[model samples]
Target: MDNQKKQPKPWYKVWWFWILVIIIVLVLGGMMNDSSSSSSSSDRKPKAHKVSPFKRTYKVGQVVNYKGYKFKVNRVKYFSGNSMDTPKSGNQYVICNVTIKNDSHEKQDYNEMDFQLSANGNTTDFGEILTSGNYENNTLDSGSLDKGATVSGNLIGQAKKDAKLKLEYQPSFLDDKTINVNLN
Candidate 1:
């Protein structure tokens, strides 16, 4: 037998395996990014984002179809804010915070939300869409968002006598359509 105790298989011996792993990792990473990028998104404002899914609330199986986006209504809260019908443009939005969580597995790069109100079978009042304008921690992930994590912003228009309402959502994934929800 050779004087040299047969050295255990060295790392270099598995060089091919490492290369294969690296290739697989790269391919997987690329695939994930491509898939996410291809997803349809809204035209809302955008900001720097980090990959972290938060949980909120939504109605079960309640899917709202907007321009083309299918948003699931997680939670609904009513607030009396500035009416979008007002003559003024700025400061008209009293900032009615609507807590929403995305149920679609697809990412929603939400920027602003539009709330519309109509009463007694009147015209649909799609409220003026408002953006949070704050991204320190306003990111809704795909699927159910964890409790406590929320994306809050101002919603134009006030509710008068429990009028019919529709909420619009803009995702932060891709540019495509808005997610509209009918809140009656």
Candidate 2:
């Protein structure tokens, strides 16, 4: 039997190794696995940012700005995108249900909903018109929401890897507001 037989373990077994591993994972992950930069374009959901944009906690009478319009959220629900049942390659979306009250009070029938996405506030040339909607409200009482009426639509914005994204809503016969969204 020879005296020089086994070698010692690599540093990875110790706390220092864990530290190095964590550092490497963070740096490399941030670069590759970043929300906007991941090569896997097929993936529908990205790793969420540290803070969510929806975390603002909207309440009644609180104005929510989408695409370009500011509307009051008398009720909140999952608004289905109403996507075609046919499966398309690498196309995925989520719909947050919303029941909006027409606080404007002018007896408005919202005909069309258009979106304008911006990267770093370049509204002229940025994202696409994610959705063009034909939304109609029978009639909203001024300052009173149609409690059970459902306003359905999807937040349709393209996935841009590793960039700042903004969503704006432009309603044909409604309101408008520039939505602020941050991506990795």
Best by lDDT: 1
Tell me model 1's lDDT, rounded to 2 decimals: 0.44
* TM-score of decoy 1: 0.27
Off by over 4 Å in 2: 1-62, 65-99, 122-150, 171-184
RMSD of each: 17.6, 21.3
Writing each residue's lDDT as its tens digit, candidate 2 over 7-45 gives 877776778889988999999888776765555663767
Candidate 1 wrong stretches, greater than 4 Å: 1-61, 64-70, 79-108, 113-157, 169-179
Measured with C-alpha atoms, the lDDT of residue 72 in candidate 2 is 47
Which run of 10 residues does model 2 get worst, by summed lDDT? 135-144
| Sequence-dependent TM-score of model 2 | 0.30
TM-score per candidate, chains pooled:
0.27, 0.30
- Our model 2 lands, by Cα RMSD against the true structure, at 21.3
